[model samples]
Target: MDDLRRIDLNLLLALHALLTEKHVTRAALRLHKSQPAVSHSLAQLREHFNDPLLVRKSGKLELTARGNALLQPLSEALGKLNTLLGTAPFDPLQERRRFRLALSDYAARLVLPDLMRYVRVHAPGFDFAISQASRDAMLAQLADGELDLALGIFPELPQDIQVQTLFEEDFICLADKTAVPDQSGLTLAQWLERPHVMVALRPDANDEIERALAAMGLQRRITVALPHWSAAVELLPDTDLVLTIARRAVGPLRAFRQLRQFPPPLQLPKLAYQQAWHIRKDMDPALTWLRQVMADCCTTGMPSG
Candidate 1:
């Protein structure tokens, strides 16, 4: 702690610039200071760290072992500091930014159409790239900076991953009208007797519906397991297979005249669909705006009931 007190915080910036540029003159140009000023800061940095951070090699400067070790941590620290102190308001109209996102196909169908329309009219310069992955993979991607945001039913999360609840969704049963015959709903016995179509990203994965059934010592026959919600719904129109899916996912497929939706026979926990990002992006204005827009789209665009 005493060592930290003796060192100047500004010298860290100079050290970063010097190590990044590897030349005092170039570092000066980056910092907008004269060559001598950067050189003086470099000398002070060497004294504080007790290492010649940069060394001359064949007439060109290169980072030493300690300098190389410091570069990534120093860069990340400085980036966080800049985010902390920088408060310039974001202008979506002028800034061109592409955000990478991960979400299930169900969420993509429920949210993307509305989100795209809103961005096109409001923030034309902003763009999005979408991918889909499992929950654990999504969290790992968020930590590794591979994905900027993820939207799904994130029930459990790491401390460093921030989350915002977009909306609560519940299960609805979909089947061919001829298959069920009853327009009201299925009884628990009838529901269990039917061959079901399970939508899961992983073939072996058990979803909330399966878990809920297991809790009651009951399990249904999943004749077909698929990773896509759209494909699963399409199969329901022709076959006797029943699909229990999120209510929001049913809105877009309402045009399927042969399919009918009914309340699930058993009570299932409401799914809180959320958007998650790394804690490092908490203060990012662009991400903040994007999250809000997503929440708004989920609220106003999707069927609430």
Candidate 2:
């Protein structure tokens, strides 16, 4: 602790720049300092840590084992310190910001259109980058700061993640109209017998539909397994593949006149679609505004199919 107190914050910042840039001149340029000043800081850092944090390897600067170990935590600490001390009143119309988000295609279909429209008119300076991944991967990305927010069915989560319910949805069966001409919906036995198209993002992960069936000592044949909701719905036309998917995902099928939606034959648990982020971001004004906008998009009569 005494050693830490003796170290200057500027020295830590210099170390971060050095480890990141891997060259004294580059680190100096990044820190807007003279090369000699940064070199002096590095020497001080090495003496304080009792290790040559950076070494010349293969004729280039490289991090030693201890330096490599310090990079991630040091980066995270600097980030938190910046957030704590550097935050300013966010102005959506003036501040240019980009957010990274993860969500299923269905959630994107439901929320993004409205969100985009609003941002275009109200927060034109804000930008978004979106990606799709499995639930576990999304959670991992959130923890690692790779993703700013994720929207999906997160039934369980770690303590460090904060979640807010956007909406609640349940399963509906979508099938080719020609395949189920009855229009009255299928009986439980008939539903179980038909080959199903399952939207399993991870090949090894079982979905809620499978879990519900397993509780009743039943299993349905999965004729197809794929990760995408949009593609899965498209496959229903001119085929016998029935997709047991979230009701919200059915909105796009309005264009697929050949597809018909039916209530699931058996009761399934309600799916709570949510937006999640690392708790470390809770105090971020920009993210707070974005989350509220998303919640408004969900509640303000966006199509629920």
- Per-candidate TM-scores read 0.72, 0.70
State the lDDT of candidate 2 residue by residue for 133-231, as single tens digits. Answer: 999999888866689999988889975578999999988898898998988778999998899888878765687888898999999988888888888
The TM-score of candidate 2 is 0.70
Off by over 4 Å in 1: 1-87, 252-254, 302-305
In candidate 2, residue 227 scores what lDDT?
86
Clashes of each: 0, 0
Residue pairs with backbone atoms closer than 3 Å in model 2 (clashes): none
lDDT of 1 by residue, 109-160 (tens): 8899888887887789998899999888999888666889999878888645
Q: Best-fitting candidate, measured by TM-score?
A: 1
- Give candidate 2's error at residue 9 in angstroms: 13
- All candidates' lDDT scores? 0.85, 0.85
